[model samples]
Target: DWVTETIVNNGEQYHGLNGDILVWNPVTKRRHELTSMGIRVTKKTLKIQLKMSGQEDFLNLPYHQALLNDEIPLSIGGGIGQSRTYMYLLRTAHLGEVSVTVWPKILKDICAQKNIKVLE
Candidate 1:
């Protein structure tokens, strides 16, 4: 995960954390993304989360107050794929063992040539 401290202060944090499985079929040349989601946090929920995370210092701050009152929308996300599970099971390079994405061209080419199957 990546983050910028100032972004959090300005209440402009961009959360890109999410879990999703990508399925690619070489023969069909098709790709699919499957996501499992839960209820997103509301502003009030954020306050609760902040408190839960021991960040209550933000209680009186505008951003913090907004969250406490449920003024902002709720959001939920996380990343997909377990590193060790894929690596051990597929006996492949780290990412290829799981349903990860953005495969390097070289890796893609090698996988294609070897007829390595991807399981989503």
Candidate 2:
């Protein structure tokens, strides 16, 4: 709600778009970047980001056009996935020990048919 609040308080359409939240891992006794994410940009913020990054031309793209026209929803999305996530969560002996995401359903069926525990 800070974005909304920032608008209400200052009449500015900007949101701080840069920082990230990190996690501390006790096992390694170090901080780790679990994911990267952002509050969906306001039209103004999007313009600023694009301009600053020398990608202002992206504004002409359909996705940006839709956003500026308020046709699509504001979104928040990011994730930590695959081998690294599995490695930390399950403490697998090696990268191959865990499936990062879903395998194809066909693969799952084949593994099942072979009595192999490959999908997890």
Candidate 1 local lDDT, 1-120, one digit each (tens): 112123455689654344445655343345543343434555555555566668878788986666566686344234442543344344554346466666778877787787774443
State residue 49's C-alpha deviation in candidate 2, in Å.
Answer: 1.0
Q: What global local distance difference test value does model 2 have?
A: 0.60
**Candidate of highest TM-score:** 2
Error of 1 at 15 (Å): 18
- In candidate 2, residue 35 scores what lDDT? 45
TM-score per candidate, chains pooled: 0.28, 0.45
Regions of model 1 farther than 4 Å from truth: 1-38, 75-120
The 0-to-1 C-alpha lDDT of every candidate, in the order given, reads: 0.53, 0.60
lDDT of 2 at 62: 97
Provide backbone clash counts, one per model. Answer: 5, 0
Query: What is the Cα-based TM-score of model 2?
Result: 0.45
Please list all clashing residue pairs in model 1, or write none if there are none. Answer: 17-78, 18-78, 19-78, 41-74, 43-67
